[model samples]
Target: MSRLFGAEPAEEAPSFFLEAPRTEKALERGAAGDLRYGLASMQGWRAHMEDAHTACPQLPDRLARWAFFAVFDGHAGGTVARFCAAHLLEHVLAAEALPGADEEDAAPGAVAAALREAFLALDRRMQALSRAEGWEPAGSTAVAVLVSPRRLYFANLGDSRALLCRAAAAAFCTEEHKPGRPRERERIENAGGTVSQQRVNGSLAVSRALGDFDYKAVAWRGPTEQPVSPEPEVSELPRRPDEDEFLLLACDGVWDAFDAAGLCAFARSRLLLSGDPQEVCERVLDAGLYKGSRDNMTCILVCFPAAPGVSQEALQTECELDAYLERRVAGSYLRTGASRGAAGHPCRLKGSAWAGGREGRPGRIWPSRQASGQVAWSSLQGPFGFSRAIADSCQPAEELSPHTDYRPPRVPLGSIFLRSRRGGGQAPANNPPPRFLRPLSCQSCTRTCCRRKRVPAWWACSKAWPQSQIPASPRAEAWPASKSRAPLPPSPPREHPAVRQPPLILWEWPGLLLREA
Candidate 1:
């Protein structure tokens, strides 16, 4: 019964990698829900023979509400690339307990520590993989994103880039971690690996990787030299409620073909048209290969739709949206702002509320409605909530205590109807409690936090929004105010239900590597 609304902690890992067409370790995803990959160990070219791609199916906002992804570039060999594909995200998300992981990992510093451990853990994991394979040839370069409705974390190792095209025009992205950076080069050298003119070992191009056991030591560490830490070049970029755009993760192959402007331009030109990530990847690759990339070329494009509520409604229920919300059918108040209060409907928000779910505060009485319909969704704090940590000492008793936690957040700003789009929605039916409430049955809706912390209570705190302060205006607002005065964008074509959005699940990876000179 307890398992339904609970989610297992997310063990994130590295992601997809594609190499030269020769060894072609290609992984591509299409309309199919499965991620198709083929690796040919064809002697000399086999390692570079394939590509890596995956098509993720979209889930109901109740499940996946965030956009999460990564890209790995295999150097020296495909080991790191393959390893990353197999396990990077898992390691990153799992290292939350390693040294320096804060009790309340809520700040940028704590996040950085987590990233550091994640990178070190990646090195450790790859070293183990190398030991298991009883050889080297299992390394990779990685770049990943941990995205949530409120924040974003972008981490990386090596020259692979993670570019964020702001929702607005004329905005560039975060700095690239390339050999061109002095500190990056110093880090490579300080690790005992020579940064020959900014490049690791003065031979390979990237400064960081997972499994380049061969180029790892300064000089094979003679029989007595200690091995160096092939830790990653990890960084953090916090995502705010405002200013979000598409992301680009790709091997140098793709970048070599397109400059920052070029890549953004190309992706932006076609993004809204396809709305499918893997297809965007394929087109990018096709563009790169055509541009004559001699190296292994791989790329991943993650597009965050600009539309609100249903984000163009991929799955239009025959039932009125109201019926589905269990509304259109009696006694309801604060429907939209209901879940935003200090405490909310345990079961409902456990279904969709910032992806924290019951993990937020078990035993805490959720906010609710007495009668009549009204808006409910608001920042966990307040209406003008700048929305970061505010040390909730003022919280009511039975509040979910502060603790280090992780929840694979659903998409950013997931579309939830605070009130009927129709406006001044109908009263909701006071339906009897469900005959069966199996917590384990609805794993997607279950909050993942309950697993680590031992909670002994479940309470509901249905407070109301203050509309009394509204001055005499032309029209009273719907509350929360969509954050924007304008309406959401046009609906995307539902021509291919199979091409639905991909689940924002955490992934796993192997180690790092160096595939080129």
Candidate 2:
């Protein structure tokens, strides 16, 4: 058993994988009644494509109003998964006590019982075939959902998962069946099999699967009581068409990449971007691939009538946010020493290190440090041109920390602007100076020392500006550089010149203030 399936630390088992991953994906889509489904499968980093899925929006026979979806994650080989995908539904429909013509007559428990019976029956058939043909040892997870007008039925035999999203939240999710689970471990031990490193007999990872015939060889144990049971755990939930948005049935590969909450959020955001279910499914597969899932991946998304639709407003907002981040990243990269122009600057911040503002605010900034690591302060009228209004906004050096550990407060995005410096200090004829919506308060700044260091009548903290050169405003006195930490002399309140001018916004860039010259 160990030789066929390999031992724990599965990554070391080179026999199960190829030299390189295959990223090709196969996608499918279909719709019936109020349910629309999209399916995507990828070989990923696996040696062969082993995952399979089934999506039936409306089942045939007497249960026309029902929808069925399932995902099978095959291990050792693809035979079991493929067989279940093609024949499981037929077996389910053929169950003697299956839900029939009268919606009211067939109880939910009866429907669940029939589904359980179908799983066991299918396993028996597989065992018979394995005995006759002498097939190689393999097993596959089974996670399926049946959607009727009033209820949803879920069944599971292995670790693949099913999730239902309602009112834009995760309403239901299935638990995985692994040998590590207490009940499953107890059952395995009772059937004379040991679980080591969370694997059955230190080999197969799943506790229950359809075709692991070797584990089902215990003569005294019944089919469901075997170390690796063929019987499935069945469950039912009341269906609410109005509140329910979508249902997700996915192989472990997809689950490994995202939790139920994260998956729901990503799907919702994708739906807002594009309403085509197939495109969304493709994107999900691509994401799972990029997120470093080395297994074959498969997923089915069944969108109910209440599923989210594309929003023009949301799309535009996302585009704008992307553009803003791109510009910031480019600016950060250019300022770093990796650029030819920035080679001389060793204190520059890397492009990837520029984090967005905390608490959902916009813009990125790192506060000034002491004299050794302090930002190279450019003159207001020097090569990096700064307007008089901006220079006037400079806060006293005593107001901020002089240590290298000073961290800056987050600034709102789109609040800061690069003013084009004119030769005669005149505003551009075509473009007026940008007005800041409000002055950023230092009271709530994250840097406690910077906030409590000093309080001035004016409302600006230009940590990058030179204290000796700060232009004195009518409301305050110019702070001398020599006595940077000294207390300021008391002065009477006066009308500020900035009141007549457009409010200027200041942002802390790394060792440099970017401007349009």
Highest-scoring model, TM-score:
2
Clashes of each: 99, 1
lDDT assessment of candidate 1:
0.39
- Error at 322, model 2, angstroms: 1.8
TM-score, candidate number 2: 0.64
Per-residue accuracy of model 1 over 385-442 as CA lDDT, tens digit each: 1111101111111111011011111111111112212111112223211111101111
* Candidate 2 residue runs with Cα over 4 Å from true position: 1-14, 330-517
lDDT of 1 at 415: 16
- Local lDDT at 411 for model 1: 11
Backbone clash tally (model 2): 1
lDDT for residue 80 in candidate 1, whole number 0-100: 63
Candidate 1: regions farther than 4 A off? 1-47, 50-67, 97-108, 168-180, 188-193, 218-229, 238-243, 307-517
Q: What's the CA error at residue 342 for candidate 2, in Å?
A: 11
